[model samples]
Target chain A: MSPLSTLTPRTLKKPSPARSRLRGGARYAPTLATVGLFLAMFAVGAGMYPSFLSGQVFLNLFIDNTFLIVLAVGMTFVILTGGIDLSVGAVVALSMMVSATLLQQGWNAGAVIVLVLLIGGGLGLLMGLIIQYFDIQPFIVTLAGMFLARGLCYVISLDSIPVTEGFFTGMAQAQIPLSGDLFVSPGVLLALGIVAIAFFVLHHTRFGRTVYAIGGNEHSAMLMGLPVKSTKILVYALSGLCSAVAGILFSFYSLSGYSLAAQGMELDAIAAVVIGGTLLTGGTGYVLGSVVGVLVLGIVQTFIAYDGTLSSWWTKIVIGGLLLVFILLQRLFARKAG
Target chain B: MKSLLKHRLAWPVIALAALLLLNQIFRPDFLGLRMQDGHLYGSLIDIMRNGAPTILIALGMTLVIATRGIDLSVGAVVAIAGAASCAYIAASPDPGSPVTAATAVLIAVVAGLALGVWNGFLVSTIGVQPIIATLVLMTAGRGVAQLITGGQIISVSNDHYKSIGAGYLFTLPISILITAAVFALAAVLTRRTALGTLIEAVGINPVASRLAGLRARNIIWIVYIFSAVCAAIAGLMISSNVTAADANNAGLYIEMDAILAVVIGGTSLAGGRYTLVGTVVGAFIIQTLTTTVYTLGIPPEVTLVFKALVVITVCLLQAPKARNLLNRLKAAPKPAAKEAAKEKVAI
Candidate 1:
């Protein structure tokens, strides 16, 4: 103890400022690149369209993509643990279908929400258990889960069910006003709240650190006595819960639930997470980065919408190209780190 | 009998037979074959003909997965190939001419090869995850296809083009024949050469293989190109058969079917050790299962649920933990003396 006390302050001086800055630069480069890209794209949009720079338009980015924000947040937690959940889109659709069916049957909105979340989380928990115990690939397991959830959606009803529930309708139209007459939807606010919680849990909690440790190296994490199994399972469960919440938000946005709702949305969520600078190989990401990723996508949609002459298919092409660019950047960064 | 039970193809063969039996039980004509205009027409023929595109794609996928990579862009590649060919045919002055059809096929193949190269470059050279690399194309490929088709379903009535997918030659469906030729080519390339071993070696351990002087990157690149080409051919077969190129729906979800086929055929998703024969059986089983679902009339969409169950069951059967649990369940019914005997033998 005496030797440790003597050696502590002098011997344990912080790293050189230059070296620390270099380390920080490498760690935050992708995220900064994403933010710069988003800002650059916004600047281009604002220059092109007179109405693109409004507070409402900016807030609309958050409003229109509340569901995506939630889904990407969930995908972040799962991806951080080096696993993927392909079933999120399907689970969202399932949750919507279940909520819609229940609400139409005169069930309470609160109960419907709880039930749907339970279903989605149950599916995720099952998939995680099978993945952990049976040693199955997460991709295949989640693919099956995707199939199951989508099939269940069709089983619920072949048509779109209108959400006649007062609570959903009220929430859908509810606006939380900001300064200068700008307002955001309740769903957007809710999504933002989730993002904040996710940010905290990911940055500060022991559970969050454990997830990063597992993603960095499962074998080492195990040797280091980290609860890899439980964390992995919980990560998936958290993803499912978020997906369910996204489904509820989606139902609010559309005021209806259809079997085919959110088709290919899982890809969008994954794209957003990746664009946010999260490595697909897992670890080294931020929940806030994922939120920024969602904003980037939202802004792209806004850009496309503002340019009315452009077709909708261009959005896909642009997104695909952007994905390529970001993935290359990630590869370069990963190479540097390695 | 025990040897047959332990055979690799036993379950798939049995599954196929069971599906056929069920169909036969429901409708005796399910297995009936008739000759018309010197061409076979029957449920069995329909299964093979309809499943050709999937089988062809699966052949490519087998090699790709054997290299421990997946190409989700195959479906998108299919759509693109179909769109390019159909668009070309639609624009051609002599649309009905065989020359035009030949030109269209060339265009499709070239487009496929180009996309394949892009995927291969990203995956092998840049060292991106195969899934993510292919996903880039999967997302945007349909849009590109739509662009080529001008967002319209281009229907071509060229007999030459039609024959590529639906035409019969020597009492056989040209689609089935095309598939067979491709299958034979893959078999010869993989089995008659060291390429298969090389691919498997790369898949089994990329780092070790690289250290051992194997060109894992090149092998991966080649497999991706091969897969894209296969997907391109499948696209031709599908669009040509329908005489219409639907950029939107063409090859939609075919990748899932191909993956399921590969998995059901006993190919591990973890990669390494693949069997083409098992894949063929798997394709037939899937086609048969789809056909069976229609016959049973439980809403065609419900087949996805059944498909999910099958995937889980097959995976569980292959999983070590499940197998161990199954063994324990089997032993729990036996006397303690039998258990002791088994333990003694294991020791």
Candidate 2:
């Protein structure tokens, strides 16, 4: 036998039951943390500002914050695969620009939506191909993608264009029926549907397992015969599709699309993902965690809004603090895992 | 001579030729080199002068990356350094005092060193990923700088402070001189000592290097401290040139620019190998691109797209896997086609 085989024979053994249990618990930590944080937010908001407990307030939250939640969900998949998609915010701007342009030309909402999704997905597919085939670093590739997409947005429109299409206006203005005057928009429902789909795909699918494997160890996964490159490409495409959806949702609230749309929003998505306990280095996270992360971020802004004295810049400081904490936690967990 | 012509530098030279050709096609007078007032003056010189900051950052970045790590906080450290320098001068006991210049420079350098050590602590001791660890400071360092300056631009009227940026030596700009001095010192230090070998060993495989009895942590710390010092020098140049320190936008997007320069010069962000010379060339490329954009009448907004295209192309060229694949694709169809044609003739 070869020397490698001799070494492998000495190393090959199944994990112990206690170790397995620990791994399982670690896997669920993010999901549990997200739920726990959400509940904590609700309790605090209800206790301190009782108006925040009402269904009407929640509906408003859904209307205003759904775009961020969608972006975070998409970022979760990218992060799980140990890659970052800095281009998502830029792509959102591009998607919105496409939607606005098509709407201006009197295109139907269905056609416009499909076109935006296709453009966004196509851009992501190109970026993914560049990364996988060229073996370039994801961060640099995505940084370039960010520049490319934002430039495309500028090429399309230098200024914000207000949407006038009937379908867009109607859908954006439409409110969900609720008891005692509470209401939500269709965009909120769409965000919920997307998030639910992402959770299911991430938790229950073989593809999800492949992603985790790839993120955990690309070389090992390749040795194990996983289709690593194709899976990575698919995940980036999925992220782009989600970003497109979020772009449309954003239009419902902002009512316009400009080259500057979603400026500095990638930072927000990353912050939410980390706060919800997603590791930046990959191989671990939950979609729900990203959702809670978004909610936490939104609520922090709401609290800051309540206090009229603090500068908006304080939000960046607070988010930076949370990022440091989460990063520290990730480091600790990484050491223990090793 | 033939083998020398086939070196890796050939591609960059060819790319440069192609760029010059493109410029000639688009703007006829782009390649013009003229002497004005006993000084070599042209768009090329301007690119070099402006790109000097990126070159300095890339020099320091080369050391950090050589140790298989990154420093995303250099930009923020730059703002802090500039703010501290300007603040010291502006808040001196005597306005425009000679002591102000010396004290400010000293304080700025020390602050940079302190921040660099803090970054090193997070990565080496806390075991944080260099990217994430440096990111914490990248965010907070700017704020710290702003807080020191009381969120205002502090103007310095001192001749000494101004000369650090605006002074020229024998027709060469001071910024260029500073860039050269730092790079030369770094090149000498690494080449002359065991530091480069230790850094490469650690970067290629940290655990194995550690097992071999190298102090990986100490090297990582030293490199970060070195990077901070380099950034401090660049910050002083900017503050002195402008004669004012604006904390908010002092070194905005510089980290990205530095990273691009490093990557373009063929330094792998994944670590192990380093090229100080390549970094200098990369800085020149970026500077020339910026100058070309303005000279060619392209709008400032479109410059990003141009930059992105260049980066993608350079990255594709530098990637061995991509090159091998392309070669395979080129050679692949020939054998298959020959076999098919022979089979047809036999039939």
Which run of 10 residues does model 2 chain B get worst, by summed lDDT?
A: B5-14
Best by DockQ: 1
Write one digit per residue (lDDT tens) for candidate 1, span A1-338: 44655676854546556777887788788999999999998888889888787889889999999999999999999998899999999999999999999999999988999898898788888998898989888988999899899989988888999998899999998988899899999998789999999998988888999988988999999998889999998888888999999999999999998999998899999999999989898978888888889999888888878888877878888889889999999989888877
Candidate 1 C-alpha lDDT tens digits along B1-347 = 98997887888888889989999999889999999988889999999999999999998999899989998999999999999999999998988998999999999999989999999999999989999999999999998998888888999889999999989999999999999999999999999999999989988999999999999989999999999999999999999989999988999889988988888888877788898988998999989988999998878879888888988888888787898998888878768879789899999
TM-score of chain A of each: 0.95, 0.90
* Candidate whose lDDT is highest: 1
lDDT of each: 0.91, 0.82
